[model samples]
Target: MRSIVIIGGGIAGAATALAAAKAGLSPVVFEAHPASGEDIGAFLTLAPNGFAALRELGVADAVAAAAFPMTELSVLARTGEVVASRPTSDSFTLRRAELCRVLQTEAIGRGIPLHHGKRLVTVREDEDGVTAEFADGESVRGDLLVGADGLRSAVRGLLDDSVVPRYAGQRVFYGHTAKAAPSEPGRMVMVRGSSVAFGYTVSPARETYWFGRTHGDELSPAEMAAPGWRDHLVELLRDDATPAAEIVAATAEPLLVTNTWDLPAVPRWRTGRVVLVGDAAHAASPATGQGASMAVEDAIVLAKALRDTANPLEVYERLRRPRAEANVAASARMTAGATDTVPRVGSARRPADGAVERMLAWDAVLED
Candidate 1:
């Protein structure tokens, strides 16, 4: 049996381990976090493509139970007028922590060993296998090494020194609130105006998740205080006449801020017996909303490639590179279109309509 060592225990790493196990490969996962469920935020959207991959890995139902199915996505102008209403058909908004729990449970059930606090520091590959050196003075060897380690991937650095992360010049604030009974669930609302965008999504448990983004370098410590930053977002959304005013007004605490970043286009993603997957291979800006979906797809496709061929390096690169590259290009386009200021909202029409569907419709299960 081929033994595989997967780095990182995020959604991508967890899914990769599950896929490897189902393919009859012995897979062990190493996570920097001390536990499986840690550092994940309030909500994330899992489109049809990601759900399909989860179903193939036998954990779709578990994840679905933790999510609220979304029926429609409405894009609105600053004045609260709907510009476009796209039928979601199949999508869910769930807590990132809950999704991680479901994937981790399935991975553990498969008897896949997961080691926490095993931060990867270096990787060395050869014709026979690959070896991963961890920060804790521990090392592991396997027939193949998969880097699901995320955007700042040590494996990616080992593979290519030219790859670097670039800031997308946007900062995001995210938080969750209890859902009111009269509130509609399973609807994703996006309000875009000026240089700001606010997204609202409700989960099955009646919890509403909110995220607001704006182009900026960084927020000072004083700017992050409750009254300053919180009030700033309130004013931004209020100026746009967003419908969730009561929800935003009720929050007394400051929202958590995250800086959006992505990698510039890289020429290659594989080296020797070591291969990169998920954000480690192609990190996308949050504007595209394809980060999680791409990661899930990467896990499924990489496992299939490894299972179908004896030349792990060649087959993995041949089958995975094209798909990852296409996703990277699509994400770059979406990010550029959304962030660019074109005066008239109609200029942004093409991107807001079909970008999501095009990403969710990709069939990563099919081999090239």
Candidate 2:
């Protein structure tokens, strides 16, 4: 049996471990966090492809229990008129921390060995296998190494130094409202402004998950986290004449400001026995809402590739790269269109439904 060593215990890492176990690989995971990933903060929507990947990994129901069903995406203009309504497939909205917690729990139940506080500092591969050296003076060797790390991946550096994360000139602040938002539980409401945009949804219990984004240079580390930032953010959008001001005012607390980033097609995703997955290989702006789903798909497709192919790394890259690249482009396009101007309800057409359906359509990737 060929052993697999997977780095980073976020969504991609956890799902990879489960899929590897299903392939009878019994891969071990190394997480930089102390114990769990329930602290990533913010929230996300799991698209249809994400749900399909979760179901394949055998944890869809568990994740669903912690998430709120989201079926429709209603795009509105600054004047509170609906521009378009798009139907979604089997989607759910939940806190990012909650999603990580459940993926960890399900991985643990499957007997996948996960080591916390194992921040990788160096990676070396020889003729036969690869060794991962962690910050704690511990090291492990495996026949192959998989990089499920995030955007600033140390493992990606080991693969090639060319793929740098590029900022998209936008930053977003995400938080949960202390009071229930007026948004519908089963729907997502988005209102676009000239320089900024806001989208929000309600949980099963009426709590709200909301995010606001604006185009600007990257914020300083201090300003990204300074106290009362939530209030400042509310003030910035107070004149939008939407529920954005109210939502920000009611948010419990402020989380970090995130500079939107995505990588152009990388020069390399695999080197020797080491390969990259998820954000490490392809980072997309949150505007896409397909990052997690693509990551999960990478895990499933990777596990299957390992199970059925002699050259698993090459096969995994061949099968997954095109799909990931397509989404990256789509995300850039959508984010650009959404921010072109204050979207008006009656004047413009929304993104083509066919384009969205193409992105959401993934039976080909999931078929046995």
Which model scores highest in lDDT?
A: 2
Estimate the Cα RMSD of every predicted model relative to the unseen true structure.
Answer: 4.7, 4.4
Note the residue pairs that clash in candidate 2: none
Candidate 1 error regions (>4 Å): 179-183, 218-227, 338-368
Candidate 1 overall Cα lDDT vs. reference?
0.72
What lDDT score belongs to each candidate, Candidate 1 first?
0.72, 0.78
TM-score of each: 0.86, 0.90
Tell me the RMSD of model 1 versus the true structure: 4.7
Reference-based lDDT, residue 47, model 1: 69
> In candidate 1, how many Å is residue 212 off?
1.2
